[model samples]
Target chain A: MSIRQIIDWAIEDSRSQMTGTIVSPFYEYSDYGGHWVWACDVDLGENLGVLRCVPVAANNRELIYAEQGRAVTLSRLNNGKWVITGLAKSLNSTVHYIFMSFTDDTYQVLRKQLRGYIIRPLTYGELGTLVVPYGYGVLPYGAQGKFDAEGNFLEIVETY
Target chain B: MRNISAALENIILGGGTRRPDYKVYAWDPAEATISEVVSANGILDDPAPVDLTPYVSDVSWSDRQLTFALVDPAGLFHPDFGELRHCLKDGAILRLLEGDETVPEVDWAITFTGQVHGQIGWKQSRSTGQITSRLTVFGRGETQAYKRRKITSQEYTVGTDIGIALYDICKTFLGLTGKEMRIPFTLGRQFKHKTNQLAQVTPWDGVCSLLKVVCYQPFFDGEGKLSYVNKSLHRPAARLFEDGDRIKELEVPECSQDTVNKVTVTFLDSQLERVDGPYQKLGQAQVTTGFFSMHETLETWWSEDRKQRADGTSMKVIKSVNSGILPVGSEHYTQLDEFHGQIEVEISVWVPILATVMIAEYLAAAFIPDDVIVLGFGASEGITIPVGRIIQAQAMIGILLIMMSIGSAQYEVWGTPYDFAYLEKKSVAVEDGLDYWLENNLDIKNDFIGTHDQADIIAMTELSWQKCLSMPRKVSVADDPRLEVGDIIGLPDGRKLVISALSKNIKRGEIPTLLIEGCKVLTA
Candidate 1:
């Protein structure tokens, strides 16, 4: 079960600014094999924060990392009008993945969480602390799946 | 559409009657066995006139009993057949040879549930010294054991699902093997019975009759399980006699003027009556719409009423039926065991109606309203009703199950009344009734001419599925191994046919002769 927290966020553009709550835990751990793996947002370059897994023996869980003290402001949106409409958290083992939904269904901030370098356990080597560090290489904004030379997402181009 | 018609035609009509090449296959399910009888009969010395006569018993549903006699030497029996007399106990299949030792693809059949019921003794012929022992067997598929059972004390709501109910009933009561029973027939609108009480009836007959009443086709497959399916829903396998098709003689019987043009089913409520054991009445309800009338009744008992009482402590009885699944799992029982000083109780101390017990009570009736089932919780030792619910005592519904009887439904089929069609009414106690339907085609019409058969539903005012079984047509084409009982085939004249019965001559290595009997259905 993944635990996601929601908070209001502000996207400030010089001329046009819109405010919406941050869809917490935008990253999810749907199919972790219990093998310790890192979830890093660095590769995404959007600095959205990492998604971490907490293996509390009695209640093992997952959560998206929100860098401590980071302002409640969002990453660049390239002028895409999206509003975080609702926030939810799931701790039910029956749920395969956790999510942070936005008003726009087509809004695609999802990415490769387990794609980088690996770790052996859920954070603490003792398995008691049950915390893991996120590790992955940072990519150029365009190289990551966010945009193309024309500022249009290749994913959207191929999907349509 | 696997078209094996051309292949069947070559063998059916192109044969040189000199002892057509074929083999006979018989399946004995009681032993879970199959056999090829290439030479079950020694010789057909006087095969002049084949004695293959197919008799559909009026007393039986689509009596596919293939009756024929073959002479053999005295006391000769196949080792595979133990004691010879018990050879036909549960179900046995008979199909003509399609060639080779392998089971044939095309032929006639029946899982003989009735005994060889005919004589198989010595016979004397006139003028010749060839006195032989003749064996006469009436292979039948009539297993009406569900008729001997009944359901009691339980009430099923009007909206209860008919398919799930029947499936559960057959699984719980019919005692059929996992593979022996199936419910694959698709129905458009499910039936919801008002509380209709039945007393000692046949659920098998009820379900089958209900299928006919609703115009759904139900029958046993080659294997022995009882399953049903809507014939019209089936895609036409092959055109029987298309123009320019390599076909044998096709005969279309003239419509008869003696056909009836109306049918009525009436089912009365049986909730207001006496229960054989110590039980308290719970509740009852009734609803009637011209098509059907439903009534529901329920009852329970007091657990403290029969305490073996060593200390006989006084307590209260619990009223009200909303215990919410009873004291609840282990938590409720633990609470129940903690005795409260004194609380006078009324009605069953525990429950107003045990859902599990009530479901078991009406499982057969609720699911398959036409099946006859009688359920009694348990009349054995190690099985005792749980006692001391909450503050007082009363009979736990699960501890004691009253027998419920569900009456059989009789399906009536007919043409548009103006068609003047002399349709053959297929009388069948479902060997297998399946549930499936296309939402777009649910409105199959039941234009009646006659609906009542030997069905035992008293107030059965109207048939549920307004469709009628009105066609009584028969076609004799070369037998195709791919055909089955409920298959709906298109004829040359654009008339669709649902195969009702099939017969074949085992001695002549004959092709299968299909019986297209039953009420005609108007697909359009």
Candidate 2:
């Protein structure tokens, strides 16, 4: 086999091995209609390997949108919009993971897990129009990057 | 230059029915960030909070003077004047934006931004029965913060790229982000900075000196970002100022006072000198003590000498390693004259014996022996005396006599070599027997000329600039809000003038006139 085929096989094997739950939490709905899930149809378009997900709020829902060849975390706010929190490696096949919680503590645990990575909070405007991220503060941090990827706090080097 | 919309340019060229007007805004320094203040436009929601356009009067802005007045008649302004007073405190931001009367507020472009300086003074006119409060402010550009940051001591070794050093200084000391700076690509001139010489200089001056090496000047554009510019580059004409244009007055004066037929640049040069080593083995001995088998290795290298520069002053040698290379040991380090010397030595090991290896490297510098000198090293045996004593003992016994004098070993003497200062001058004569020579002996204290080629380039640039400065024109025109510093205006005589400095005053119910100083005029 060619080197590219060998690399693809190794990547597929690694992706298969990493298909497990990173974190799980219990959630309950008052309506007894089962916990709400912020699931959306995967949009790969002409590009089949990449997943294009819109930012949404997930106030009271579980996020389960997934695509092939890519792995990412989607957090839902109480307002039912889902947002991308972090990116992941190892996703050779289509996989979906639902993360549901009753409080912000579960997301805090995930934030602690992916410390230094830049986490963007995707939000929506009135009329259900998706508000594209603009300026800087759209992330949880507004130009002030606090935690690094390894969960280590960085020292602020400049003061005005 | 700030790019204006075509409609705005038409308004400036006096082609529109609506005339240009300016609005002033004020923000407290502690209450708002510069990014917010810079991007603020009072369209719907005011970002700067306070509008000072109603009370602002006698507004004038120039390179040297930026002053305005706020008039109050029997306190008719009431709470608005009080609010304006609160916003006009010291260090408060004063922003001026220009737009026509009928245009949308978003079309207004910022004309000037400054910070309040000193105390706001008040004066009363009994005849007019009105009290005037005058406020003076200083233009705070991008380099203003860097001008306050002082670097006590810093050094860049010879062959250091000027561009990278400047970027490092801006990033480390000024805390400027990558987007805030636009340094040109690395010109191939190497820069060397002496720590003692640049012991106390602000980052602004440091940046200016580095830019001066490439004949460039540092300036802040309208967006308040630091940029390097070379005026020698020809720029296309921005606008033509001819008849029917709103020009008040124009004068082109020819003077030979600034004409240069010669330019002299004095720079320090490193002159190399070679000195052989003071390496010698006084004596070797084999002794067997209470051990079954023993082997020992002993080697020594030492030098003692002093050299002076061509200026007849004692040379000061400094140990400096290249940015990435590491020094081997205390005895194996590179040293050069503190002021003007380049590092030309390669790192290598010198072995003396086959069985045992010795790393002998000499970057030795001049030594001033005002007192006693002693040199010592360990031998094969455990107990030992000083090498001087061993020499004395050998001389007293007369059996193992070996004279260890100066220049005994065949090794290279490594120390700071004497360097001298030389003047590299370039000249261009415009006419024979009519020499209008303007010479400038640049003080090495102010100029950073490290290499000979760099000095030549700087001298040529100075010569060209001086030649261009021979013809300066002062032009007075109606205030055009679209006009900016560094804009080129075409003259009537098929010549182009680059606007170097400008002064203007904006008043109500009257035309604002501009005074422009064009330092260089080129053929159209």
Q: For each candidate, what's the DockQ? A: 0.01, 0.00
User: What tens digits encode model 1's per-residue C-alpha lDDT throughout B305-391?
Assistant: 321111112212232222333332110101112121121112232233453444454443333323323345563434333222311
lDDT of 1 by residue, A1-160 (tens): 1111111122122323211112122233432455543222221112112222312121213222222111122233355422222111210000011111112111111221111111111212222321224222222111213232233333211100
Restricting to chain A, the TM-score for each candidate equals 0.15, 0.19
DockQ computed for model 2 against the true two-chain complex using alpha carbons: 0.00
lDDT of 2 by residue, B41-110 (tens): 3321344357778878889877444678877655532334554455666677777777777666567766
State the lDDT at A38 in candidate 1.
Answer: 29
**lDDT score for candidate 1 against the true structure:** 0.31
Candidate 1: Cα lDDT at B494: 66
Off by over 4 Å in 1: A1-160, B1-63, B77-115, B118-121, B124-127, B131-140, B144-160, B172-174, B185-199, B209-214, B229-240, B254-260, B263-471, B506-521
Give lDDT tens digits, candidate 2, residues A29-138. 23224645333222221112222233323442333322211234444445543444433321111111111111211111011011112111122221122224354334
Candidate 1 CAPRI assessment class: incorrect
Worst 10 residues of 2 chain B by lDDT: B400-409
